[model samples]
Target: MEHTQPEQGGLRESKRRDTLQRVAQAGLELFLARGYEATTVDDISAAAGISRRTFFHYFKSKDEVLLAWQTGLVESLRQAVLQEENRQAPLDALCGALLKLAADYDSDATFAIAQLLRSNDQLRAANQVKFLQLEQAAFEALCHLWPQRRRRGRLRMVAMIGLGAFRVGIDEWTEEGGTQPFSQRIGHAFTMLRAELQVASAAAPSQ
Candidate 1:
């Protein structure tokens, strides 16, 4: 039997990943503590113990660094949705996945991140782009649970609707000062969404 050779550059790749995470985390901290506009690239590099050139080697701008940090959650969110593959209702599965994601978030940190993302014009625009990427990720994950050709459209819809409710839920949770658990806020939003869907279904004409 032939044995696969050990992976190349394993330690170097890991060190690179660690350095990137450190820089991104540091950038987020400064953005939260000093406001996004006030935090400089040097501030993040100093916090992460890297030079400005090293920072640029990892990221183009501070905004990109922060968004890159936020993007880390996307893979986790995708995995959460995939874990719901055994559930019967696609909509319920999507909401359950969302709630799973919500439960994992630190409420205070989540609220702070929300505020940070919405604090400035550039971040706000980037946040919107991030939402679109999330929606696409959700749709692709849902397709794994229901691969039927006819179900594709509905699965796509579920992804869009689920994320929409989730976004609104987070906005409301932050607006309320994060007193409520993020899971409960998201649950309520999904409930209201289900009610609205039921009404729309009932009002539609029979085929």
Candidate 2:
């Protein structure tokens, strides 16, 4: 359902969301089945059981339909980071937000969406842009958690590197044909990162 989260329209009424996801699901499936360039807007509208007008109401283009699932992620992840139930360290909390997002994803569908995006140059570039937004969102969430005004630079670094680690984890997952849970891949990346840092610190020349 990557699981079909379509906050991209920014209009979160129940029916509106349902329609948006329905269209996105249809479009992504067609894109995977037929071919991104070959699939037209009309095909998606027909597949989703929506009118052409309805399709445009939710998505700007076929590409947008594939990408719409990723919109509104910035704020959602921020709120997830703020949840009271998660009492992890700052970096872990940030990653936790992302883990929560992936928790409900349909793994095969998620892999298909990733494949769809990488199948084209424009989509790949746009995908990179979305990830950049995610990094900024992570940074802001960390700032909210620790607003002492002293760790600004460090928080920014964490946000950047945290997403980097996530990218690494995702890359590894996809490379391995997505056999394992994405959260597991992400967790292992962070664990290995922390372990290496400890070893490096322990071996460092004393100041």
Candidate 3:
């Protein structure tokens, strides 16, 4: 039988996960019942059985509670892309990571986020803004993995285009009456982008 050794970092990570879950669960329930704007930091802290100071330690603001899952998801995608084996082409790694994210978000977390954003106008706006930020972050993360020359012109263009396609994919997935899973929607968007890129690539030299 193989045995694994316990590590100090693992223990700290476990504790951090527990605290985050507790805070997020409490915050979500309060937001759902009392409305997001009406729900204060104090309310969330009380519900989580934590003090205001403690809540501040975990989350900067109530709005950030709703954004926590999204921010984490984006960071995870970036890390996955950075860590992929033999990723000589930044575009390939980015697209693959994005596809994985699409599948991941097809789970309950992204569904719940979609519901919340759709239900509330303020949250919708907030989510839109946050997604744009995430797209920029994703581009920068990918750029970091590439050499400086690749990040300068055409490679940067590819990243921008890829990120824009991802935004479109997310919008399609979250749109009202859209029955498709987020993964499928995002995949479709990527397919479309790839087709367009191929066409542009074919035409550029002839022009």
TM-score, every prediction: 0.90, 0.81, 0.72
RMSD of each: 2.8, 6.8, 5.3
- Model 1: which residue pairs collide? none
Count backbone overlaps in model 1.
0
The TM-score measured for candidate 3 stands at 0.72
Instruction: Report the candidate with higher lDDT, 1 versus 3.
Output: 1
Candidate with best lDDT: 1
- Candidate 1 Cα outliers beyond 4 Å, as residue runs: 1-8, 85-87
Candidate 1 lDDT, 1-207, residue by residue in tens? 233333446767889999998998998888878988899999999999999999999999898977876766788778888998655788888898889888988568778888887778988898898888888888988898888889899889888999999999988888888889999999999999999999999999999
Q: Cα miss at 7, model 1 (Å)?
A: 7.0
C-alpha lDDT of candidate 3 relative to the true structure: 0.75
Please give the CA lDDT of all the candidate structures: 0.87, 0.81, 0.75
Residue pairs with clashing backbones, model 3 = none
lDDT of 2 by residue, 1-207 (tens): 553466633446877878888898898888889988899999999999999998888888788988987767777877887772435667778777777866756388787777777787999888899889988888887888888689889889988878888888877888888888878887877888788878999999999
Q: Answer with 1 or 2, whichever has the higher lDDT.
A: 1
The 10-residue segment of model 1 with minimum total lDDT is: 1-10
Summarize candidate 3's per-residue lDDT along 103-204 as a digit string, tens digits. Answer: 777765576566666666767777778666656666667666765764557656766777788888877776743578777887888899889978989889
Q: Candidate 3, which segments miss by more than 4 Å at Cα?
A: 1-17, 33-35, 83-89, 118-133, 140-145, 148-151, 201-207
Clashes of 3: 0
